[model samples]
Target: MGKIVFKRLVEVQILHDYFLTMGDGISFFQRNKKEKEELLTQRINRGLYSAGSIFKISPITANKLRDNKILFAETSSGFILGVEVDEVIEAGELRFKPVHDISKKLDLSFSLTTKLPFFKSFTNLELEKSLPSINYFTNKKATLLNENTVPAYTSMPLTKTAPAHQAGETYEMGTILDFGGTIREANQRTDGNDPAHWEDIDDRRFVTRADKVLLPHNFKIKFKDYQLVTQLEVSLEDTGNNKIKKIVKNSAEPFKDISLNFSKIDENDKDSPNIPSGIYYLNLKINGATEIVYSILLDNDLYDYQNFGVVELGFEEVNSPYSLLDTQGFLKTKIEAGGQKVSHPIFEIRLKNRRSYWRYKKNTDFTPSEIAATSNHLEVAASNILVAKKPKALTETLLPFKNGTNLLLPTPKVAGIRVENEKIYSDIHINQSNGLLKI
Candidate 1:
């Protein structure tokens, strides 16, 4: 029925150990990371913990005394009854100075001399028990009071699709007449209707027009149908890692809303090649009701096999098999270390030349020897890559090769020969007679 005036009072309590706590002693205090530890504890202990005492006194009756630090006192009796002292300045105001001073004309008590600490270093020191409580008499009945200052509240409608507020924007609420059993407008209106009886309710009290009653009073709204979308675009990168990089984008799609769930797959062990490998997967979702799962695979570094072993071959070496063959049918070896005339299989085919020739050579008729050699080469390469067992050498030469295998080579299985393939799904075998690998 009346207006209520609300006054705010902020109390900051100073602890006796505040200065000591700030010194380089406590690990957290020195780090300054937990600076709020003492302050917050003081606030909780003095403010919230003493809410009943604070509400019953102070600005509610008397204001808090401001000094180097906050000081709480009782003003309900009108005079500032110093209950807690933070410094000598605060104690001086409460008449806690010595009575035997030169200016002894003022009224002072012996309690003040005994209660006040020696002047110099000071802190939040309580004197309630050391000093006697003084009763300061005052007239509370003389202060003017307004009975019409009662508390009133207005509902705050939740905003829907509203833009952020800008400077100078008007904040107004349309008037409402009886509907939700509550008066709608906030402040009193100026239009004169009831001269003697003025209700704290706004002048725009009743709905002025019939159309105004039908208009939606609340503007806030909630979405009815919502959805979410998440996608990961994967592309190949020509890097040493030879990995498929994925770009993830999540959205509610048309609605522009999305939710995400992140979890670590502790039990998921990935050993096979196909399934992507990662320690954790990010599960994306849309609104709590509708979900979109987006799996985030951890990234890793991988070395390319092609770049390796290239440096071992000299700079004069060609990059591909075709280039190597173009330079020389095969790498020329010393026939007899300073003698170039003799013959003893004086050259070896480079791996690059072999791969290039195999990649570009026209599909030709595969003789039985060529097929066998191709199979042997593929088996050996696979074994090297997967660390599997080497294939058995099945060499059958038409020439009178001693022991049925190549006489020059001691073992049918080329023990020293190292083979590797870079092409996708490549299978090659060596043919003894043809002396070449067939794919």
Candidate 2:
């Protein structure tokens, strides 16, 4: 019975759509009673959309409805709704709230207030009533504040000793002090130790007092390439008497070492008198140009080694030639003995003995003994060794000098021609099998 009822309902909905599609206007009105009531409410709401009306409610009545879900009101009421007679009367008594009182709330002193006039409406007041004028000048005069004034004196008297002036004490004009034999004028309140407040009368005396005296000592200056320098001159001057003393003047071959000999008047003159002890200015000149000037004090009581010692100076030349030859492999070089028949010329070969995975077979022909007797005799031989099985990179090499002074020539770079079948070859050739081989 339930199924039959549902089937009839479905059939009715189908027929309703069919009639509407067939241009039948009566089918829409034939809808269920509930749907017809919803259509009527929608038409009434459309009329109310464009209409508005005023509402009048008391504050107590609005407050009661504030909690209502459907028709609720906020705590803040409109001016016409919540206004009371007492509140209106109290607002009139104050007229305006003083903005100056806000300083107390902000935790500031009341004396620091801007002192602005309170706000007031001019409508209720009489037209002839005058308003309070604002005074912009609020600072008090220095005289009324009991502040010190500038003195009329031209100069202050000089003090023989350092003044013990306090930190905040004020002084009149012409206040001076002889602080540690230095005349300094007090430009402001000073602690007497600060140099900024004092004006220096003699700058030279201050410099002399601050100058450091040195003992008599030997000086030596070295040049990287002394051959390029055409002339070198050094002099000593007595600072007190301005007496100049010639130290060294070299116009010929410039020596590598420039040293001062205090025992003699000059570097080469041993018979001359020794230099006296005093403060002297040492001046170094290169190519007739002043290179440097140094003040030195010589004390006779101190020994030569006890005083300030040798000072080594060097000039950097970008174009100077390097003393060592940096290269890889063997090098063959000759040394000219100036056509003098030389016998048994010393030859040395240096190589780093690094560990290898496999031992390399040494070639006997390139040994130092065999190569020393070759037609192209080697005066000095140095090179990196590279085997066919083992390869290595070239590292920096330092040439050993004879007697720690005479520098030897650097080793030359050499490349191997070929090596195969337990034999070393100096040239390349094509073997019988048409394969490249060393011979």
Candidate 3:
């Protein structure tokens, strides 16, 4: 009886002609439930046709832990997914494991994530809201459970330190390091170098007093394909007001570990740029491939009067000679809360299949090639990003409020960024009272 009703529904609005058909004898369907709306995009129902080309995409704001089944289909413009999270489970500690075969490819973060049985995990949050205060551990001790309230802990002034490994040592060749210090250590983790397995390296975050000094020192960084000296430049500066000014430093480091001794530009050297001490920005220019990568550390704090910046690096692809990701290209920004503070900052942008996008931007090597971003202000063009395997359609937005606000309506909230597929729909809009929407 249920199957009869579903077949009737499929018959209600069937298309007369075929547009896309898979290898098997599956058919495509369409309806004029409002012809214009039908022309925009079609939703794939589970039982309407062969599930071969059937794609499913959940609404943008769906909680990933819901155990939603996200299967995708390929399209010329991009991929299409029909999402259904009807079988939701209780949200627990976030956990994900990278797909092994995908990792072996020249893809890093682009590696596919599978539902692995790890004990813990967390997602980057938009700046307006606090991340779920999970016990985040580094090379140190940790708390037993998740904290509901963000305890206000005072922070000590930050110090920039780089530790070099013994000479003649080589790592598995992963994310590049700026100081040539601690780059290999992150993937190696606290257990020390483990050629047995790999771990995701959390971006280093530091809180500092504006007047803190970053004394100069010598360090070594390993670059792939060529000697340490090919196409590398280091710029340290301030990026608080949404612009970049060279934080004038004098670096004459040219050899292997690229010594970085930054000193104030002298008056006699008026040509040198000047940098005031408040928040420091670290920028690195390097060639990026699947293997050769680097890391830039910045402040991941949410408190006011906090000084921070992120490490931004750019690299050229060895195969195509095209740039892959932005050098600090994707915006990781923060805004002041409405006279209130939160626990920690969430990453403003989320890129799905980030590595996959690089894999197929030029060729059709992969299927279901898509990239997803939940950001407040994202400009792919400025970053030279122009494509997403398919055109994205907004399903629904997930938003969080501040200062005990309960309502989730557009009237009171700011919609800072709206992007889909490869087109920019809405520009970033914000108010001092209400910063970019923490979506």
Per-candidate TM-scores read 0.12, 0.20, 0.20
Encode model 2's per-residue lDDT on 53-170: one tens digit a residue.
1112122223222322112222111111111011111222311121111111111000011111211110001111111111111001101111112321111110012232333223
Residue 416 CA error for candidate 2 (Å)?
41
Candidate 3 lDDT over 1-439, as tens digits, reads 2221100000001111122222222221112124312432443432323212221211221232123232333332222322221111123211122111111112111101112121011111111211111111111111122112234122211112223332232332121122332332222212234433223322222111111222222223344333343445555555453333222222344333443433344434757664343345555554221122122222222111111112111122222112221132211111123423222111111111001011111122112211122121122342223232222211112222122343221221123223233222322223345433233
User: Candidates ranked by TM-score, best first?
Assistant: 2, 3, 1
Which runs of model 1 end up more than 4 angstroms from their true locations?
1-248, 251-361, 379-439
Give the C-alpha miss distance for residue 70 in model 3, angstroms: 58
lDDT minimum window of 10 residues, candidate 3: 4-13
Question: lDDT for each of the candidates?
Answer: 0.21, 0.27, 0.24
Instruction: Name the better of 1 and 3 by TM-score.
Output: 3
Which candidate number has the best lDDT? 2
Candidate 2 lands at a TM-score of 0.20
Model 2 is weakest, by summed lDDT over 10 consecutive residues, at: 5-14
